[model samples]
Structure formats: C-alpha cells, structure tokens
Target chain A: MNDLGWIDAALTAARPQAVSALLRYFRDLDTAEEAFQEACLRALKTWPQNGPPRDPAAWLIMVGRNAALDEARRKKKQTELPEDDVLSDLDDAESALAERLDGAHYRDDILRLLFICCHPDLPAVQQIALALRIVSGLSVKEIARAFLVSESAMEQRITRAKRRVAAADVPFEAPGAPERAERLGAVAAMIYLLFNEGYSASGGSVQVRVPLCEEAIRLARLLLRLFPAEPEIMGLAALLLLQHARAKARLDGEGNIVLLEDQDRGLWDRELIAEGLALLEKALRHQRPGPYQVQAAIAGVHAHAAQPEDTDWAEIEQLYGALERHQPSPVVTLNRAVAVSKVRGPAAALAMIEPLAQPLAGYFHYFGVKGWLLKELGRADEARTAFDRAIALANTPAEAEQIRQHLDRLKEGAQRKSGRGSAHPAQS
Target chain B: MLYAILCYHDEAEVGSWPKEKDDAVLAKRALVTDKLAAKGRLGPVVRLMPTTAATTVRAGREPLVIDGPFAETKEQLLGFYIVDCASLAEAIEAAKGMVKDGGGAMEIRPLRLFRPGTTAGALAAESVAP
Candidate 1:
C-alpha cells in the first residue's frame, strides 16, 4: 500500500484505543479530541520519514498526551516548549504503554467510550450522531451528508450531545459484569439504529447513505471481538451481514424500490450470505434464541433459497411467530402476514392484519399490505383508498412511487372493463 | 466508585395508587437497602416529591425559573440511590435489587471525583513540566 493508505488504515485502527486513553487523561471530550488531532498531524508529517510505529495506538497516545500537556504548560508560562527531538522521541515510552494496554485495560477503555456515546440521557438521534463522530471518527460534514441534514444543524446536534455527556459525568472506571451487559445492550441498539438510518434512506437517495450501514457493520464486528462467545452478538453481526448482502438488488437502476420477491437473486453477495449462515448456525447451537437470532434465522432461510419460489415460507412464518413471542410488536405481526399470504392465501393474510389497523394507523407498511390484500380480493375501490393512505404515509419518494405503480394497475383494470361495457351497449 | 441510580416512573400511575400499595412497594425497597447496607454498599437514598411541586431555574444575566421538570417525558424522576461499590457492575446489581416489578427505568451515572487542582480553567503547570 501507499504511504497515505497505510497511514489512514493505522489511524482508523488506533483511534478507539488512543482516543479512549486520552479521554481518560483529559476527562473532557473536546480536550481529548484536540489531542488526537494534534497526534494525527504529527503522524502525517513524521510517519513518511520515520516509518510507521510498531504500535500506532501507543505512539498516538503518548504523543497526544504530551502535546496536550505542553499546551497546558505553555498557557501557564511555567515551562518552555520541548525541543523537536524530544517531542518526537517515543520509542521506549510507546513500547511500555503498548505492553500495559494489551491487558484488560484495552477492552474496558474502548467499551467505556462507546457506552458514554450511547448514554441514556441522550436521545437516539444524538446517540447515533455522537457515536458516528467519536467512535467512527467521521467528520461532521460527512455525517451530515449521510443523515441528509445541513452541516450547521449536525454541528449543533453534536455539540449539544458533547455538552450533555460532559455534564452527565460518566465514570472512568471499568464496568462490572452486570453493567457491561447493560452497556452492551445499549451499544447493540445504537448500532441497529445506525444501520436503519442507512437502510431506510428514502426517495432516490439510497446510495448516498450506504456508509452508515458499513460503519454499523464495522462496529458490530468490533463488538464481536470483545464478546466473542456471546451468541446474541454473533447473531447481531450475522443479521446485519445477511440483510446488507442484498443492497445491490434492494433498488433498481432507476432508484425505485424493489420487492424481495421480484428482485434478481443473482445480485446477492454469496460471500456475506455464507458468513451470515455460519454465524447463525453457531448462535442457534448455543440454545439461547434471542430476538436477533430469530431474525437472523429468518434471513438465513431467505439467503439459502436460490430462487424466489424456493423460499421456505413455512419456516419464515414460524420464525416470525417466535420473534413475536420474544419481542411482541405490531410490526412483527404485520411482517408475519406476508408469510401467511404465501403459505395460505390473501384472505387469511387480510384477516391477520385487520386487527392491526387501529394500532398501526400511521404505519406505511400497514396500508401497503392492506392495499395488496384488497386488490387480490378484487375490492379495487378499497384497495385504492388504502394505497392513497399508504402514499400519504410513505417515508421516501421511492416508497411512494412503488405504491403509485400499484394504483396505476388498478386504474388500467377499471379502464379496460369500462371500455368493454361501452362496446356492448347496442346489444344491451 | 460511587454510582447514582436514578429511578423514573409514570407519575400519574403512581399517584393514583392506594396508600397501602405505595407503602408495600416502599417496604420492598427498604428490604433491598438493608441487604446492601449489610454489604457496606449502600449510601444515601433520597426520594423527591412529584413533578407538580418541582421548579427549574435557567442561569443567565437574570435567572428564569420554570415551574416543572426540565423536560416533559413519559417518565419522571421519582427517586435516586447512591451506592458505593468497587466497580460499575456491583453498583448495577445493587440498583437492580431495588427495582420493583413493572418499574419504569433506572439510569446509572457515575459521580465525578473532586480533586483540589484539576479545574479546567486552572493550568496544572507543575504536573505538565517535563
């Protein structure tokens, strides 16, 4: 790899450890961030000449901590600035620090940093924005583009989040087992939220926000490293991989939404599917089926199907049934109705979701499914009304367009029948 | 390390309960506190009045006092417990022991330690000197 490429990879790999350690020393977000930046600048200048450090994280931590201290001393006028040779000399100290960080200190520091970003006091949006900024090291502008918000608004959101985190006074100590479990749950939820933000990108903008999905997958892999034996973590990672493998066929070339049944299965990434299936198998063998594991199992069924008709709808329905019992929600039932339509018929599917209307009144998928069932039953007028509601509640332009196409089909059927009736008027 | 377990609950639901039911719930919490005290993990336990009796003051040139909690949410802060433990895990166990069945939520936050000369405004010149 080129020098810049190597430097970039090293920095990305080192950020979690180096920044976590710096945050420990400074006890403040802005100060820790400033120190990390200075270290990065020094790396850009010195790495090309001195060659990469044996432990990049250790090198960054030592240099960043000293730089911040130097700035502090300079502000007080108590000591002169260090000579260039002294500032850059980190061979012995970096090795010692690296040795110390290899112990339990490494995992705790990174996990604590992640927990702070997803602290309960912050809203979900702020939690996501903060994690993207601090953990993933995305620039504010880059994060703004991914969320489809303006730069200034995203900046304010991040600033406010940082202020709240500092005020909240998160602990610097390693969490105990129970607390680790709680924090792990929080982190998993945050990662899922991040993936959804990318997955649900609306209108013609599906490709613009794909980086969020990749980042979430990356963080999930990191979590798996920390808790390798935890089945749910494995399940979570597998679920994201299985779903993301279909990104290529999720939308057509014209940026329109494509239903899974109609999508070209050839476009799916087999490598990711294989990895997901392996993880799901291992997780299921653990005999602890959580919501994520059940969902991954369902996705695994889809991945194993080579053709659309080959999909095992019966197993999917059972998995959804398990999911409903595990974490009951109206949305789960709505999804199960689709499987029911395949296994049974449109009548049973319609009956299944008829009771969900009151609870899912504003839900777009509710109306979409209702419209499809109504259309299948030859109740065109009711289906048209349902489609109108679905369009009104559509989250993105692509989703709205998908419903509009269905409406057009109904319109054509009506026009054909009316034209036939007029041509037979003399016989009548 | 000292951790604060802040308990939040639906105020309306709690307020409508009978006095006997409230006392019974409090009795269960007291049992948990007694257990923690035996282990030397318990600290101060404080229960605040309802949000109806709360006030907020915004600092500025002139302070603005709002007559409710800082923000309106589904759950309101009803009480808190301070627990001293070796690590966050112990503190969480203590908090979980006290939580009632069907309770709303508990937020665990660590309290900052007070050191003499670590203020952001004050430069730690002596410590920084090479």
Candidate 2:
C-alpha cells in the first residue's frame, strides 16, 4: 500500500479511541477535536519518516493531550511554540498511555463519546449530523452534499448540536449496565439513520456514498461487541447486512432502479447473506422478539430464497404482521401490504391498504404499490393516475424512471387493445 | 455527577387512583429514597402539583401569561428526584427503584454547572496524572 493510504487507514481506525480519550481529558468537544487535528498533523509529518507507532490510538491520545496543553500554554505565554520534531517524538508517553488503555476503559470512552454525540436533547437531524461529523469524521461539505443542504447550514446544525450537548452536561465517565441498556435504543436508531443516509442515496451517485453504509456496519459491529448477548443488536446487524448484500443488484446497467424480484440474485454477496442468516437464527432462538428482530426475520426469509419464485411470502406476511403489532405505523402497514399482495392477491392487498390512503397520501411507495395493484386488476384509468402521483412523489430520478416504465407498459397495452379493436370491430 | 430524574405519568390515570393506592406508591418512593440516602446518593426530591396549577410566561413585544404546562401530552411531569451518582447507570438504577411498580416513566438528565470561559488545562491536570 502507498504511505498515505496506510496513514489514512491508521488515522480512521485510531479516531474513536484517540478522540474519546482526548475528550475525557479535555471535557470539551472543540478542544478535543482541535487536539486530534494537531496530533494528526504531527503524525503525517513523522510517521512517513519513523514508520507507524506500535499503537496508533494510544500514541495519538497521548500526543493529542500534550499538544492541546501546549496550545493553551502558548496562548497564555504569547511566545513561540515548541518545534515539530520535539513534539512528534513520543516513545515514552505513548507506551505509558498504551499500558493504561485497558479494555473496559477503551470501551467506555468510545461509548461515552457516542452517547455525547447522540445525546437525547438533540433532535434526530442534529444527532445524525453530529455523529457523522464527530464519530465518522466526514467533512461538513461532504455531509452537506449527502443531505442536499448548504455547508453553512450543516455547520450551523452541528455547532448547535454541540452547544446543546455541552449545555446538557453529559457525564464524562463510563456508563453503567442499566444506562448502557437505556441508551442502546437511541444509539441503534442513530446507526440505522446513518445506514439509511447511505442506503437511500436520495441524491448523487450511490456508489460514491457507499462508505457510509460500511461505516454504519462497523459501528453496529462495535455495538454488538459491547452487547454480545443482546438479540435486538444482533438482529439489527443482521438486517443491515442482509439488505446491503443486495447492493450490487439494486440497479440495472443504465443505473435504472431494479425491483428486488427482477434483480440478478447471483450478484448478491453470499458471505454477507450467510453472516446475516446465522445472526438471524441466533436472534430468533433468543425468543425476546422486538421490532428489529421481526424486520430481520423478514429480510432473512428473503435472503433464504434462492429464487424469487421460491420466496415464502406467507412467512414474510406473518413477520410483517408481527412487526405491525410491535411497532404500529402507517409506513409499517404500507410495507406489510407488499407481503399481503404476494401471499394473497392484488385485490386483497388493495383492500388492506385502502384505509391507509389518507395517511399515506404523500408517500411515494404507497402510490407506486397502488398503481401496480390497479394495473393487475385491469383498472387502467386509476392505475395511470396512481402512477402519475407516484412519479410526482419520487425522490430520485431512478424512482421516477421506475414509475415511468410502468406508465409505458400501460400505454403499450392500451395501443394493442385499440389496434385489435380496429381489426375486429364486431368483437369490440 | 448529578442527575435529575423526572417522572411522567398519564394525569387522568393517576388522578383516578384511589387514595390508598396513591399512598402505597408514595410509600414505595420513600423506601427507595431512604435506601439512596444510606448510600449517600440521595439529593433534593421535589413533587409538583398537577399541570392545572401551572403558569407559563412568554416574552415578546407584549409579555403573555399562559396557564398550564408548556405542551399538552398524554403524560405530564408529576415529580422529580436529584440524585448524585458516579455514572448514568447508577442514577437510572435509583430512578427504577422509585418507579418499580408505578405506571409511569422517568427521564434522566445530567445537571451541568454552567461555567463560562473555563480552560481545559486545569481540569486535565486535576483528572490525569503522568
């Protein structure tokens, strides 16, 4: 690997521990971040010459702490700071901190930092923005592009989140078991949002933003390590893996959206699917079924089917029913309707979602599904109207193109009928 | 660290409880508080009257006085406890003890001493030793 490539990987891996440990020392987000940046600058200068340190995280934490102190001292003294060479040599302090960085301390520091970023006082948007900026270390401009917002707006949002967190007075110490359990739900939700931010790809090329998905998976794995026996966490990790396994087949050659049933199954990642299935099996055995477990069970069912025709639609429908009971919402009902259509028929599925029309009027998938069901039932006029609505609500060009394809099929069918009518006027 | 555990319960359900039932719940809370006191984690406990007795002040070009809680939710804040603990887990454990059998939820928020212009050097030196 190239020198800078290895340095990048080392920096990304060391970020959580180094930044968290520095946060522990500094007790301020901005200070901790500035210290981390200074340490990184030092590493960029020294690692190329001295080779990498034995423990990059420990070295960064020690060096970052001292660098921040040096800055404070420099500001107080109003004199020249120390030379780069003097600051970069840290053989003794690095090993000393490495000795003190025990497993419990490391886990708690990382968890504490995550909890601070996802503090309950902040709104969901702010939580996501802060976590992306602090934990994943995404640049403000990149995050702004992902969310389709101005960089200044995202910067303001992150600053406001930090201010709220500091004002809320999050504890600096390691959380206890009960507190960890309490915070797990919020943390899980944040991770899911992170994954969705990458998975949805509402704007821009999805291939370029797939790193968010990988980062989210890494965070979920870290959470799984902390709560190994927690079934919901296992289910969550499994769910993301199963969904992401199909990423390669999610679009066609021209980048048009491909429905799950039409996608090439061979393109799916078998390793990720295998890992997800194993986790789902373990989670189901735990029997403490929650929303995540139910959703994972549904995804597991889909993954197990080698071909679309072999899918157990009945089981998927039942799982969605269980999910609906566990977490009742209009969106959940709309999803369950898809399984309903597969198990029963279009008529039954249409009736199932008829009551959801008012609530899901603005929902894109609702109209798309309604249009498909209408088309199946030979209700051409209503189907066309629904497809039009779906196109209007589409969030991406691919989504709109999917609906337009349906409209094109409808037009073709109409033209064939009219041409047959011209040939056989008595039958018409 | 200090945390305030705010208890929320459906007002209508709480209002319908019998006197003896209410007394039993309060008795359970007292037991938890006594245990916390023994552990030297107990802090000030405040039990507020219902939202009906609340008055809200809104400032604008003309100050407006509004009656009742800030927002109408099914659950209303009924009481609170400030507890001293080493971590959030301890505070949550303490809060659980109070609301074990009570049909309500508690929210734990860490209390901050807002000190502006505080440098990190002093805190770092005090907390970390080489």
Report, for every candidate in turn, its global Cα lDDT versus the true structure. Answer: 0.75, 0.74
Query: Which candidate should be chosen as best, given lDDT against the real structure?
Result: 1
- Candidate 2 chain B worst ten-residue window by lDDT: B121-130
Candidate 1 iRMSD, 1 decimal: 28.4
Fnat, one value per model:
0.00, 0.00
- Looking at model 2, give its docking quality level: incorrect
Q: Which run of 10 residues does model 1 chain A get worst, by summed lDDT?
A: A419-428
List model 1 lDDT by residue over A1-428, tens digit each: 22254466567767877888778777778878899999999999998788767567778888898898788757546555455333343323334455454646767778878888997889887899999999878999998888788999999999999999889887877788998898888888899888878887643345326678778877877676556557788789889888888888877888876777767778887656766776776677678899989988988888877776787989999999999999999999998998888789779989999999999999888898888777777789998999999999988788887888778877887544432111100000
In candidate 2, stretches whose alpha carbon ends up further than 4 angstroms from where it belongs are: A79-101, A120-123, A203-208, A414-428, B1-130
Error of 2 at B5 (Å): 55
lDDT of 2 by residue, A170-276 (tens): 78657778887777887888888888777776565442246677678767766765565678988898888888888888778888777777778888877667667
Can you list each candidate's DockQ? 0.01, 0.01
- DockQ, Cα level, model 2: 0.01
Q: Which lDDT value does model 1 have at A64?
A: 90
